[model samples]
Every structure is written in C-alpha cells, then in structure tokens.
Target: MKRREFAALGLASLALPALAADAGFDGQVEAFLEALWRLDPDAAVAAGRFEFAPQITLPGSAQRDRQRAFLKHWLAEFENRSDATLSVSQRMDRAMLIAKINSDLWQLDTLREWAWNPANYNPAGPLDLLLNTDYAPLPERLKALKPRVAALPAFYRAAQASLAPNGGVTREHTELAIQQAPGVLGVLDDIAKRAAEAGQAATFKAPLAQARAAVNGYGAHLKRLLPSARRSFRIGAALYEAKFAHDIQSARTAKATYEIALQRREEVLAGMQAQAAALWPSVIGAEAPPADRFALIGRVIAKLSERHVARERFVDEIRAQIPQLEAWVRDHDLLNQDMSKPLAVRETPEYERGVAGASIEAPGPYRPQDKTYYNVTPLDELTPEQAESSLREYNHWILQILSIHEAIPGHYTQLVHANRVPGKVKALFGNGAMIEGWAVYGERMMIESGYGASPEMTLMWGKWHLRAVTNTLLDYSVHTGGMTEADALDLLMRQAFQTEREAREKWRRVQLTSVQLTSYFSGYSEIFVLREQLKAKSGPGGFDLKAFHEKFLGYGSAPVRLIAAEMIRS
Candidate 1:
C-alpha cells in the first residue's frame, strides 16, 4: 500500500465558518484556549504557562480524549455565530480560533499515523518542544515529569493496539521502535530519579513508580508486537496521494511542487551568479564560471578568520547593537508592539553538529517564559585542513550575513515578534517557509540597506543566496533518486561554490530529512516577489523596511499567498 492510502483514510474536510458575531467573541476564544491549556499543562507551559496558573500535571490519554471531546462540543455550540453580532476585531479573532481548532484536530488525527516514526516518537524532537527549554524553572520541569512518566503505559498500549495482527505497522517502524525503546525508558528513569532527588510530592513519587512498572510491561509488549510486524502492506496509491496533499498543504501534487521548486532554483542560481560576477570582478575575473565563485568566497573567509573576533566578543557586539535595532523598530512604529522577552545568544552542542550552521530555537505557542536562542557553532570540530577549507568558505562578509540571518532582524527577532501575535491558532501553524524565507530576505534587505556596506560582504551574501537556490535543486534531485551523492557534490562544488565538506554535509542532511531544504529557495523567492509587489504598490509611499518586516511577521508563518491576502486585506 502507498503512504497516501493511510492518509486518505484520515483526510476529512475541515469545516470553517464565515466571520462570526458575538460581543464576547474574542473573550470566548481566549477562554477556550485558556481552558485547553489547563487540561494539557505541557501545552500550557509551552504556550506561556508561566503567565497563567502554576504548572499543572499533564493528564493521561483518556483524560485528553475527554478534553478533546469537550472542545469539539463547545465549538459546535458556538458554530452559528454571525459577524453582525460582534465587533470587527472580535469577529476576526473568532474566525482565527475556529481555524486553529480545525487545524489542531487534523494534527491530532495525523499524529496517530506517524506516531511510529522515530522522528515523531523520540524525546529529541516533539518532546523537546514541550519541555520548555528556555522557560519553566528546573523545579517545574521536574514536577511535570510525573504525568509524562505516568502516561507511558497508555502510550505503550496504543502502540500495541496499532501493531495488532495484520495492522499497518511496518518492520522498519518496529525495528526503530525497539531501538529507541531503551532510550525512552532511560529518559523516564532519569526523570524519575531527578524528581525523587528534588523531593517531589508523594503524588509524583507514586506515578514514577507506576511508570517504571509500565515501562517494563511495554518492553514485554514490544517483543510480542515485533514478531507480527510485517515487511510490507497494500497501502494504495490513493492513500499516498491524500497523505501528500495534507502534508504539503498545497494544491500542487508533490511531484509538481518538486518540479516547480527545481525550475525556480535554477532561475535564482543564474540570477545570483550574475550578481556575484558584477559584485566581485577581482575574485572571479568578471567572466568565470559559477563553480569558481566558492574559491573567491573561500579566500575571503580565510582572510577574515585571520582577524576574526573571539566568540564572546562577537556576542557582546550583537548585544550592544540590539538596543539600536529595537529602537529603530519602535521609532518607526513597526508592528505597533514590543517583544515580550529579550533575545539571548547561546552556544550549544547541537548547533555544533551542523557543518555549515547556525539556528534559531524560537519560543513555541505554550512557551511564554521562553528565551529565544540564536546558536552559532564554532569551527573547532573541523580537521585543520577542513577548518582552513571552512574558513575560506565562511569569510568575514559571509559571517556578517549569517549573523543577520540567524540573529538581529532575522530569524530570532522575527520569531520573537511572531510569537507575540494574539491568536493561538496562527501561532501553532507557523510554516518554515515564512520563518526561513524572512531571514533570507533579511540578509538581502540588509545588504540593500547598507547594513554590511562592503563590496566583499555583498558578494558573499550573493554567494549564500546562490547556495540556497542550489540546496533546493539538490534536495529534489537526491530525494527523487535521480541524483547520486557524487552528482550532488559536483553540483554544489560547481554551482554553489561550496567546499567538499560542506557539500557532503548537505547530502547527509537531505538524506535524513525531506522537504525542508526546499524552504530556503521557496521562501526567498516568495519574499523577493512580495517585496517587489509591495514596492510597486506603495509607490511614493515607499517600502518601510521596518514596516514591511513587522507586517510580514505579524501574519505568522503561513504560505506567502495567504500572507499576501492578509496583508492586502488589512
């Protein structure tokens, strides 16, 4: 059976009502979300649980089911509200709430299907999202573990049922589950030990004991389930098609989307190459092939590192600049809001893992006390030769561009603002394209605004933009099984001007994940077009970089088309 067949079984059209009327529409929506947070404390903490009540224990699956049913019933009761009865803002808030609940329902149902995938099941990903990395004190984290530990039995039982005789559980999934089971158990054990050491309540102590027994039972259950896990099944193409539709959230089929992204990538690459040539005549001698651009970039990086500032110094510089950036936004009245929390720059082991890297770990919807992290990995891991190679590739200009991309006026700042948007549903459906796209867009915007005034800096930014385009092409090529590792490496080396190490790292990332690479080019392209359109539309009114940015982020991270509609309507 194809993957889509399973998706089709779960694909039901979401019902979205027209604008609604009610004097207290906004209040009702807020109350609904507040109630939801109370029921699911993990979500509440994630959504800014610190601001509301103290941390509550997460309920088990049966309790969650009852809560979901109650929400559905409440939504049904409020479904007939018409716009005429409510104020404009209240009506808009209600519509957003309804949309959010529908999206949440879809997510809950879809999660059951993908639950076996280690990416979804392991503590590293979704679990990390809920753990409040930046917010919730250590005591809160310790206290919250009781319910998660308590809930392990129910999770295992669900897994067992899903793996029942002739069910859809695959051998690969079962093997991964088995492999990850020990890690899961270990996490639970760690949590229990921590809670006990912290002198948590008897309520917590009792649950931890129960969790240990349940985990042991789950291990036994897994052995029974493993024997019946099949190598394959008859999931039809229709199901695969449906799944693709839901996952991509676009009208185009996956194949079509891949193709469009491929073509757009080539166009962007050509444009960037032209821009690079014009900006760096001495580096490439004005008529060099696109492949030789990396050598120039490498030389530039090597020169920069020779004079590179220490990490602490660089961070201090960024910290000092924040006040000016923040003031610029306020003076311009961009978005008409202030950040709920200040941004912090941090170094972490995880960020160090990526070869060509930096990342923004933004606050989630439930993460009110969240501190945004702008993580920049050092080049310490590279072999001396690899280090030199990377240095050449990441020159000073490139470093500045990356800083702008990952920190100030980029992902971290943009997301901090995005999280402050008033609606819960908008926050939950945040798309990667908008987030990454805006950052990439910021790099170019800063260059155009003279943030990094040097010709070398401009050229380096062009090179990275070119790489983003190349990434999109390689992602589609490798995943469709059309491009070999060697071919991918050669393309990166030739067109994007990346080192062998950079190329190989990208290949590994593509192998581990699909669809994410496309976001860079897709997002950049959309932002580019939007900027042009905004420029044209505004005329003498002109484009306010601050205003454009604030407005863009205010819409959350939905598709550019939806964002465009919202912008135009507003």
Candidate 2:
C-alpha cells in the first residue's frame, strides 16, 4: 500500500484504545485518538495497526496538499481539547500525539530533497514486508493485493509527474529504480498466480489481474518517461540547506556534521592503531610502522567466515539465540512493550536485488499477523574466483555479526518496540539515522559485553565499524566534490583495509545513495556521545545500558538533539 495510507492506518490503530477504554476522561482521550486514526489510515498502518479500508493513492502534489490539510485539522482538534478532562496518562499521550503530528507535518514540508531518489518512489519494500510477515495468511495476502495493486497507476503517474524535463534519470539513482521494477513485477506475478489458484474471484482475482495489467503498462510508460527524467532541476543550495534544518531536524549543518564525524574517525583509528600495537607486540610492536587497518580487519573477517557454519546452519544459530535475546530484554526491563513473536530468518529474492546485507521487515498497520524477518541475500551466478570470495565473506563469524545487526537487540528488537510506541508522530517521523544508529550501536554493545570473544568475531565487528567510518567520509567527500570514486576506493582499501571486492561494492553503493551513507557514522557518533554523557551524569548508577537504551528509544526516532531534550526532561 501507499506510505501515506499505511501511515494513516497506523494512526487509526492507536486510536482503538479510546474506543475500548473505560469511561470519563480516559475514554474521551481515547475517543480523540480513535477519531485521528479514522482520519489518517496511512499513519495508522505505519504504527503497526491495521484498519479496514482500501489504500488511498493520489498524485504527489495532491497527496502533499491532502497531508497538510489533515495535519492542520488534526492539530486544531488537539488544541481544542481541555487537559482538565483527561487523566495524567491520557494527557501525556495526548501531548505526545500532538507533538508527533506537528513534527510529521513539518517533515512533509521539507522532504523534497529525496523526491528524485527511487528508494522512496516505489512499493517493493512494503511488498517484501507483506510477503515476509507470518501474520499475513494466504487470504490476507490476497486481500492486501487490492490496495497495493490498485495504487500502481497512481504511483507511476506520480513518478511521471516528478520527472525532470530532460529525458534521463539522475545517473546515480537510475539503477535502483530499474532494479526494483523487475522485482515489483515479480511480486505482482506471484500474487496473481496465488489468487488464481485460490479460486477467490471477487477480492483476490479481480484486483490481482487489474494490478498485473497496470504494472505492465506502467513499465512501458517508464521507458517513455526515461528521457525526460534526466534533466536536473535547480534544487539550489538553499533548499538543500533547508533539508538539513527542517527535514532532518538537525542542528548541525551538513558540512559541520561531516567534519565532526571525520575528526572522530581519525581519533578512533589512532586509538585502534595503538591498541593493535599493544596487543600484537611481535607483529606490530611498541612503535609500529604504518599498517593497513582495512587489510588487517579483512583478514580477521575472512578467518571468522571460514570458522562458522554455512547458510542454513548459520540461520539455525541465529534462531537459537532469539529466546535468549527476548529474555534479556524482559529480564532487564529494557523497553515498555512485549515482543514475544519469534522472528523468521529466511533468504528472499529481494536480498539478491541488493536491498542490503540484511534487513528486518516490521509489521504494517493492517497486518494483524506480525512477523519480523531476518533476511540474508544469497549470491547468484558466481565465477569460481567470485564464488570463493563470496563464501569467504559469508562465513559463520561474519554471519553472526550480521545477525546481531539485523536481529537480537538491534533493528528487529528496536523496531518492535518502536511499533508499539503510542503516538503517530514518533512512529511516522522515525529517522533513518536513529534506526540505523541503534543497530550499529547494538553490534558494538554486544561485542563490549564479551560477545566478540573469538578473533573472527572481533574482525567482523571491526570490518563493520570500518565500513561505517568509510561510508561517512565517502558520503560527504563525494557530494561536496572533494573526492572521486578512485579516491574512495583507495581510502577503503588502504585505510579501511577492505577486500578489493568489498571495497568496489561499497564504492558503487556510495554512488547510488547520498545522505544514507552518512547515517552509520553520524548515528554511531551521536549514540556514542550520548552514551558517554549519560555515563558521566549517572556515574556509577548511570551506566545502565538497558535503561539508557530503553529511554533513548522511548523518545521516538527524532534527531539526537530532540532525544537529548526528552531525556533531560525525563
């Protein structure tokens, strides 16, 4: 379904408590939340609540206007309420809801920077989420086809409308959209086949057929629109500046942020170098000569991968850890929610499409059945040399590091809690930096907690950290015109010590995505600083990792500054 519609559905789900609450003040507040939900299905779905309604799809301009109007009305209604009539908890929820709505409204106005990127354009991500969720039965999956399939034409029309006057897409973004298109079609075909076999003509068959035809038509239309897509509109530096301020809600300018991260990276590398010298005195004794950190890390990673089990066995190890991880969350009282459902680890076709090394598909608003997915993309069509390289990279220790990043107290765990957050604002305004930062932080936290006892594990974590550092530097340097792809490759190989294949793949990723590359290093630095500050303030008692994390996540995925404000207030 469309993102807006999913978001509205999420808002609606949060309102259900109002309809089910006890009478008087609490009931009235719940009633208000319920009303907001009915008004915004898109918000509702995003928050992991489902409402029974067809997805709403519209042209980009039209949707923007509609979203603005909805937020205006929603805000007004919230302001009209009297706090005297509500209980304390109800009042807090109301305040949070209003804050969230306002934040999202502001974000909507400033999110034009990403308009040209295909990552935000299409429906493949959501489609994968639906297919991966255990809660979605065959019938439910078929039912979902209506809104998703129906929305294709509008999505295409919006893409066409958003196209530049020149007849080509931005060279960097072209590959992602084109790659995702075939995958989307593949999904549509799968749904169509499933619908036909079920013999359910009304809900499933008709919509599926309509959607399949539309997708085909849309593909043809895209080719026609491709030439016009190439022209660059003058987004101007002012708009780009505004995107950092309003869209990201960040205090740091893009340049300032990049500088801070770069400085921190140099400091970290120096520290690591010192540690390497001390730990391996014979290899790189007291006053060690220049050594490639990337190569050292890569060698360690290669060894770890070899030591671990292959794919299926690796998946089993991850699955086995679920109960332990879940119990850890509960035993420590980390966050304010229950996430008992077992996450499934599977290989998906999208994995092969370069979605990421691994990812978690959180539950949608209308999906009552929630299943968290831990996905690993399998390598396809490898030459003998390539096959050996691929195997070396996917080795057991490396897989474990990946598993920690995608599952455990990482993305899956954090997302589950995030889904359960009561207000639409926190849910809808979720920041990429926070989401990704928390996952990277989780990986390090595990290692610090002694999870990285083996040499392979240490190497794997080090490799990931190097990637984060390299990604941040590349993102800024490439965009600001200070560095070329060759420079980036050299940095990755010489400084980060990545394998030739890994370095090349990362260079391509850096080209394909802009701001996203900065997320890892920026996020890690933000969290690292916050953790240090918290430790200093709390001193002996303040060093509770569980408490700090739960509180950090409770504020929703805002910029680190906002999170700091909330933490201080709490």
Candidate 3:
C-alpha cells in the first residue's frame, strides 16, 4: 500500500485476510499486529518493519480517532477470547495486548500527551534510526525517508493544531521541545551528509531543507507558546494515580508504593550509615565523623563521589567497563550472559537528552540482531561546575554500578533475553518496572555476588540503591502530593546523596515526566520480594540464584508481579 493510503486506513478498512469469525486466535493476532503496525509506523519501524518506513502518523483528530477505533476493535476481539482455550503463551500475549490496548486508549482519550507535549511531535527518532542504523542500504533508507521528510511541514502544522490552548501546554514541555528542536536539525544534517555519501544529495536536498525549516519553525512556534504555557507540568493526583497504574502495572498501588519507598528509604539509610561509619577512617582519613548519621553518610559519599573519571574519559570509561562487568557476571555464574549480542556504548544523541543522563536504546524484537546502544550523555555539553558535579555523581564505584545497570547483566542483557523470548508482544510492550527493576535488582545482585565487594562498594551501592528508592518518593510526592523543588532537592542531595547537578536535573525530569521515576524501585522491590519468598520456600541450597534470575527474565519483560506468579506456579 502507498504510505498515505496505509496511514489513512482505519481499523475497519484495514486489509486483513481471514477476518471471518473462524479465523482462530493466531489469525486474529496476525491481523491485529498488521493493523497496529500500519497505524503506528514509528513502532513498526522500531520493530523492524521497514516497509512502513516512509509513513508518518500526523498528530491531529483524524489520526487519533482512527487509533481510538483501532484500539477498541482489537480490545474487544481480545476480550471476547476465552483464556482457557488459549495456549499459555497465547494467553500471556492476549492479556498483554489487551492491557496495551487499554493503555493506548487511556493515553489517547484521557492523557492526550499530543495536545500537551510538543516534544511528542518530533520525527527525529525513527528518522534517525533509519538513517543511521544500517538496517538497510543508504539509498533505500534515504529514498524511504524522502516522503516522510517531505511531510514534515504538515506534521508540524498538525502538531501546532493539536496543542491545547489556554494553559494546556506546560512551559517545561514547550521549553523541552525548543531545546530538542536542534536535534531534529541535527538529524537532518546527518541525513544530508549520508545522502551525499549515497550520491543522492541532490534528490534529498529540497525535502531535507524543507524538513529543517519546518523544525526551525516548530521551535519558533514553541518559543511563542512558552510565554502562554500556563499548564503546570504536574499531572496532579487523579492523573498520576491512573498513569501509575497503567505504566507501572505494579501489584501495589502508587500510594502503597510510595509508603513502601518511604520505608525502604529508612532501611537503605541505615545500611549506608553502617557502611560509611566502617569506611570513614579509610575514605575520610583523619576527619571526625559527624554526630548526625546523615551528615556522616553525606561526608563519606561526597568524598567517594569526588573519585570519578575525567570529563573527557566519561563515555569511553563506560565503554571499557562493559567487558569487565560481562566477565564478572560470567566468572560469578550469575544470569546467563549472551556473549554474541553487540553492546555499543555511545554518546547520547542530541534530541534524546534532557530526560535522563544515561539510558539503553535496545532494538525492538523484530530487529534483535541490531546493536543495543548504551547512551551516555557526554560531559562536554555541561558547564565546568555542572560537569564536575556529574563526574562526582557518577564516580568510580557508582559509574561501575551504572555500567552494570545500563549494560552487562542489566538492561542490555535483559533485553537480549527479552528479544529471544517466545512472544514478541512482551518484548515490544515491556513493563517499564520489570525492565528497570531488574536493572536495580541486578546492581544489588552483583554486589551480593561479590562484584566490587568492599565496604566502599557496598556503601556506594547503598547510595545508588537509595537513589532508586528516593526516585519513587520524589515522583509520587511531587505528582500526587505537590512536592516543592526545595524539599525535593533536599530529599535528593541530603538524603539520597545525589549531587546538586543530578538533583536539579531530576527535579526538571519529574516536571517533564510522570510515573517513570518510580519504575526502578517499584520493580526492584517486587522482584526482590519474590526471590526471597522462593528462596525461603525452597529451603537452603534448593533455590538457585542463577536459575531464579534466568526464569524471571525468561518471561520477557512482563510485570514483576506476573512473573512472580508464574515463578511460584512453576
């Protein structure tokens, strides 16, 4: 189908074979997936459906209505199916797809991020993937990118029309969009360079220029909206609760998780204090320990934080650490490590920054063979003070922890396992808590397994673990309870031992995002509890830690609670 024709197709009009009632569950799943890919081309491309590469779904009423109809139809179809008749895998996929449908519907009808978040309109991501990934030849990728690039003007216009007026647009989001606008320009510039390589520079010149101009215009539009952007970034209570449920899918409620995080905070603090007190003489030298416990812990952590790599070596340092982590996991006989998979630690792309400093950009299940990017935002972009603060925040020990979290047996390894799982749905629609929780869990698991086995390492891990606990507190309190910046900063810098730069960015992050910060602790806590329960049930030496890790991860990024149930049953 032509890009526009496919883009314009509603669920009802979608070309699907075996639409008859007797098509069976597999047929229905196939049909639903086909329609889904056509509707959301960005997801399609991510999942390695390059045929949809040229299409861009416009962000306006027409597309929203089409998506609403698409979600409702599939949701009903999946709902009608009896779980008893389906195979175990099919049942899991069906449940996941239904949940995904409902989540998409909620996002469209209730959340309506397109109307509020101008940053949602950027076409840089998919376009960049196509241009850079070598998923296909340059000429073909550029050829496919042309029409989408040509449609940029209309896309931005629709985005402008989609924004809700009279305080719907948040200043932070608008400002974020403006900051990221250059990223779109950067993508275009890169695309131009590639097009020149392909000897198709002349062909792409006009559209690329038009696309660049449109991006610039969008930035200008957001600049105008900034003055009038009165909507608070806080989603408030009701929205926060709903979003938390949808996104986290935790067994516990958001309020319950917040309480648990509060409790976890105290436990982590106690652990950190003990570790710090033990290491104080060595780390802090002749300095006297503070009478206050927190003050003492802070002093020790601050001293440790100062022992980071140079700003220039930051990204390379993360790269070099990956092999060491992999070797450690292998030597320790931790979870099964996939040695064949490629993990490339790179500088965070321009447009993808502003949310978190470091993250993993794993390929979708369809393209499992692609390199998983460990994106570390380089320190060159920061001011001297800011750079020093970041360096301190991700000091030698914590940087190793970060490496384990983002690479090795953390996200990259988990994702590799996820991609190899039986069902693509779970890999594609992964639970954020499960993914992040496993990373948090991995950090602790590594320390427990004797990687970086020192009081200093233990103490740093405690500080790192505390960061996850505090993230939940910060996110829940800020969104639901109206946490002010001062209190939040104090909670981070003083209590969690985060550097000032890290805390400030997190404050901005909490404003720009909702419910995400809670993932690490929420997932980690559930996974930890499940592991302990199983270990206790199995008696001494019966439960294998490696077995438990492998089994839990084998569920392919399903929620920790669901995985726990499966584990218990097994």
Candidate 1 C-alpha error for residue 70, in Å:
7.7
lDDT of 1 by residue, 1-570 (tens): 010000100000111223443537656666776677666555554455544333443333565476668668666745766667864335445554565555456545643444333223333222343343535675776545545556656655554544435544555445544555555555555555555666765556677667667656755665666676663422233443344344334434645656766676566555555654555555544455445644545444333445444433544544555565556435544334345565676554341233235666555555434566666556665577776565556555666666667765666666656555545555554555656677777777666766656656655666677777776677666655457778988888766677676777777666544556766666677677777888888897777766677667655555565566556655
Q: What shift in Å separates residue 447 of candidate 2 from its native position after superposition? A: 1.8
Error of 3 at 193 (Å): 1.1
Q: What are the per-residue Cα lDDT tens digits for candidate 3 across 1-570?
A: 001111110001111122123337778887887888999888798777788998878878999999989889889999998876665556667877888889999998898888899888878888888887787778888988899899999999999999998768999999999999888899899988988998999998889888888998989988888888988888989999899889898899999999999999888888888888998999889878998988999999998888889999999998899889888998999867767778788888898888888988877666677787888899997899999999999999999999888877787888777766654677777788888888899998998998988788889999889989999999998998899999999999988889999999999999988999999999999999999999999998899888787777766767777778767876
RMSD of each: 7.9, 5.8, 5.6
A best-first ranking of the candidates according to their lDDT comes to 3, 2, 1
Better of 2 and 3 by TM-score: 3
Candidate 1 error regions (>4 Å): 1-24, 27-41, 50-116, 124-141, 150-267, 271-340, 349-357, 364-369, 376-395, 475-487, 540-542, 556-559
Model 2: residues with Cα > 4 Å off, grouped in runs: 1-49, 71-115, 118-121, 124-144, 147-155, 201-210, 224-241, 246-251, 275-339, 349-352, 365-369, 381-395, 419-424, 454-456, 540-543, 554-559
